[model samples]
Target: MLLALLGVAAFSLTFPSTAWGLESFGPWSLVALRGVLAALIAGAFLLAGRVPVPDRRHWAGLAVVGGGVVVGFPLLTTLALRTSTTSHAAVVVGLLPLTTAAFAALRTGRRPSRAFWLAALAGAAVVLGYTVRESGGSLSTGDMYLFGALLVCAAGYTEGGRLAAVMPGWQVIGWALVLCLPLAATGAVTALAVEPVRLTAHGALGLGWVAAGSTFLGMYLWYRGMASIGIARASQLQLAQPLLTLVWSVLLLGEELSPAAPVAAAGVLMCIALTQRARS
Candidate 1:
C-alpha cells in the first residue's frame, strides 16, 4: 500500500509537470525526447543489474507496455494539455481506476460482482457528466485525446501488472523501455530534425521529472504494488490521484478550483469505494 501510494503520488504530478514543460518545448519533441531519456536510464539500470535478456514471449508484452505508456500516453496527454488545463485533464483522467479494472478483468478472465459493475457505471457516469458539462456539452479535441490516452494507459497498466508478477517491478519497466529504445531514438532524432527544441531550465526540469519519475520510477512502484496486492484492488488507489493532481495544479500552476471539482471528486470517490467493496 505504501508502494502504491508513492507511485500514485509521483503520477499525480505528471500533468502539472507536463504543463510546465510545454512552456518551452513542443509536445512531439517532449514526448520523443522524454522517452529517449528514460530509455537511457532504464538501460543503465539493466546493465548495472546484469539482467538477462527477455524471452520472445516477454518481448511481445514489453512492446505492448512500451507502446501504450512510453509512447501513447505521454504523446497524447502532452498534445491534450496544449489545449486543456491541468485541472481539466486531471478530472478526466480520474476515470483511470475503472478503466484499469476493466482491463484487469479482461487480462485475468475474472468477472467482478454485479455490484462492482453498478459502482463502475455510476463512477463513469459522474466522470462523463463532469466532462460533458465542463466542455459545454461537446467533447473537445483535448478530451478526445485524453480518452485515447486513458485506454492506452489502462492497457499498459494491466499488462505491466501481469509482467511484474513474474519479474522485479523496476526491471519490468526498464526492459519495456529498453525494448523500444531503437524506435524512441528514431522518433527523437526525427522530431529534432523537423524542428528545434527550446528548453528553459524549468522545462528541462519538468521533462526530467516525467522521464525519470513518471515514466520509470512510478511504474516500478506501481507494478510492484499491483503484483503484491492484485491489480483490481491496487487500481482502487488511483482514485486518489486526481485529487492530488488538483492540489498540485492549484499550488504549481495557480489554477482556480471550481466548487464542482470537489463535489464531483467526492461523488466519483464514493463510487470507487463501492466498487472496491464488491468482490469477484
Candidate 2:
C-alpha cells in the first residue's frame, strides 16, 4: 500500500510535468523523447543489475506493456495536454483506477468482492461527475485522447501486474521499457527532426522527472504493490491520484484550484478506504 501510494504520488506530478515539457517540446517530440529517455534509464538499471532476459512466454506481455504503457499512454496524454489543462486531464484520468481494476479482473480471472466493485464504481462515479460538470457536458478532442489513454494504460497496468507476480516488479517495467527501445529511438529521431524545440529549465526538469521518476520508478513501485496485494485492491489506491494531481497543478502549474476539489477528494478517499478493506 505504501508502495502503491508512492507510485500514485509520482504519477500525480505527470500532468503538470508534461505541461512544463510542452513549453519547449511539441507533443510528438515530447512523447517520443520521454520514451527514449525512460528506456535508457531502464536499460541502465537492467544492465547494472545483470538482469537476465525474460522468458519467451513473457515476451507477449512485455510487448503489451511496451505498446500500451511505454508508448500509447504517454503519447495520447501528451497530445491531450496540448489542448487541455492539467487539472482537467487529471480529473478525466481519475477513471484509471476503475478501468485498471476491471482489466485486472478480466486478465487474471480474479473476482473482487461486491464491496470492492461497489467502492470502485463509486470512485469512478465521482470522477465522471466531476469531469462532466467541469466540461459542461461537452467532450473535446483532448478528452478523446485521454479516454483512449485510459484503456491502453489499464491494459498495460493489468499485464504488468501479472508479470510482476513471476518476476521482480522493477524488472517487469525495466524489460518492457527495453523492449520498446528501438521504436522509441526511431520515434525520437524522426519527431525531433520534424518538431520544433525550444529548451528551457522547466522542460529539461519535467522531461527528466517523467522519464526517471514517473515512467520507471513509479511503475516499479506500482507493480510491486499490485503483486503484494491483488491488482484490483491495489488499483483502488489510485482513487486519490487525480486529487493529488489537482493539488500539484495549483502548486506547480499555478492553475486555479476548483472549489469542489476538496469535496471530491473526500469522496474518493472514502471509496478508497472501502475498496481497501473489501475482500478480493
Candidate 3:
C-alpha cells in the first residue's frame, strides 16, 4: 500500500507536467522523446544491475507492457491534453482504478466481491459526473483519447502486476522499456526530423519528470505493491490520483479549482476506501 501510494504520488504530477511540456513541444514529440529517454535510462539500469533477460515465453507479456504503457498511454494522453485542461484530463483519468480492476479480473480470473463492485461503480460514477460537469455536460475528442489511454494503461498495469509477482518490479518495467527501444528511438527521431524543438526550462523539467518518474520509477513501486497486495486492492489507491493531480494543476498550471472538485474527490475517496475494506 505504501509503495502504491508513492507511485500514485509520482503519477499525480504527470498531467500537469505534460500540459506544461505541450506549451513548447508537440504532443507526439513529447511522447516520443519521453519514451526514448525513459528507455535509455531503463537500459542503463539493466546494464548496471546485470539483470538477466526474460525467457522467450515472457517476452510477449513484456511487449504488452511496453505497448500499453511506453507507447499507447503516453501517446493517447498527450494527444488528449492537447485539447483538454489538466483538470479535465484528471477527472477522466480518475476512472483508471476501476478500469485497472476490471482488467485485473480479466487477466487473473479473480472475482471481486459484490461490495467491492458496488464501491468501484460508485467511484466511477463520481468521476464521470466530474468529467461531464467539467466539460460542460458534453463529451469531446479529448475524452475519447483519454478513454483509449485508460484502456491500454489498464491492460499494461494488469500485466505488469501479474509479472511483478515473480520478478523484481523494477526489472519488469525496465525490460518493457528495453523492449520498446527500437520503436521509441524511431519515433523520437522521426518526430524531431519533422518538427524542430527549442527546449525551455519548463519543458525540460516536465519531460525529465515524466520520462524518469512516471515511465520507470513509479511503475516500479506500483507493480511492487500490486504484487504484494494483488491488483484489485492496489488499484484502489489510484482513486486519490485525480485529486492530487487537481492540486498540481492549480499550483503548476494556474487552473482554477472548482468547489465541486473537492466534493467529488471526497466522494470518490470514500468509495475507494469502501472498496479497499470490502472482501475480495
Candidate 4:
C-alpha cells in the first residue's frame, strides 16, 4: 500500500507536469520525447542488472503494456491537455480505478467480492458526478480523449499487474519500455522535425519528471504493490489519485480548487476503505 500510494503521488503530478511541458513542446513532441527518454532510462537499468530477455510468451503481454501505457495513454492525454484544464482532466481520469479493476477481473478471472464491486462503483459514481459538474454537465472533445486514455491505461495496468506476479515488477515495465524504444525513437525524430520547440526550465523539468519519475519509477512501485497485494485491491487505491492531482493542480498550476473537491475526496476515501476491507 505504501508503494502504491507513492506511485499515485507520482502520477498525481503528471497533468501539471504535462502542462509545464506544453509551454515548450507540442503534444506529439512531448509524448514522443517522454517515451524515448523513459525507454532509455529503463534500458539503462535493464543493462545494469543484466536482465535476460523475457520468455517469448511474455512478449505479447509486454506489447500490450507498451502500447497502452507508453503510447496510447500518453499520446491521448497529452493531446487532451492541449485544450483541457488539468483539474478537469484529472477528475475525468478518476474513473481509472474502477476501469482497471474490471479489466483485472476479465483478464485474471478472479472475481472480487460483491462488496468490493459495490465500493468501486460508488467511488466511480462520486468521481463521475464531480467530473460532470465540473464540466457543466456536458462532454468535450478532451473528455473523449480522456475516456480513451482510461480504457487503454486500464488494459496496460491490468496486464502489467499480471505479469508482475510472475516476474519482477521493474523488469515488467523495463522490458515493456525497451520494447517501445524503436517506435518511440522514430516518433520522436518525426515529431521533433515537425513540431516547433522553445525550451524553458519548466518544460525541461516537466519532461524529466514525466519520463523518469512518473513513467519509470511510478510504474515500478505500482506493479510491485500489485504483485504484493492483488490487482483489483491495488487498483482501488487509485481512487485517491484524482484528489491528489487536484491538490497538485491548485498548488503547482495555480488552478482554483472546486468546493466539491473535499466532498469528493471524502467519499472516494470511504469507498477505498470499504474495498480494502472486502474479500476477494
lDDT of 3: 0.91
* Cα deviation of 255, candidate 1, in Å: 1.1
Taken over the whole model, the C-alpha lDDT of each candidate is 0.88, 0.92, 0.91, 0.94
Worst 10 residues of 1 by lDDT: 190-199
Best by lDDT: 4
Q: lDDT tens string, model 2, 1-280?
A: 8998899999999999999999989988888888889999989989999989999999999999888889999999999998999999998999999999999989999999999999999999999898888888888899999999999999999999999999999999999998998898898899999899999999998998889989999999999998998799888888888989998999998999778888888999999999989997
**Candidate 2 runs further than 4 Å off:** none
Q: Report the C-alpha displacement of residue 24, candidate 4, in angstroms.
A: 0.9
Candidate 1 or 4, higher TM-score? 4
Which residue pairs overlap in candidate 4's backbone? none
Please give the lDDT score for candidate 2: 0.92
Candidate 4: list runs displaced more than 4 Å.
none
Backbone collisions counted per model: 0, 0, 0, 0
lDDT at 121, model 4: 98
Residue 41 CA displacement from its true place in model 1, Å? 1.1
RMSD in Å for model 1: 1.4
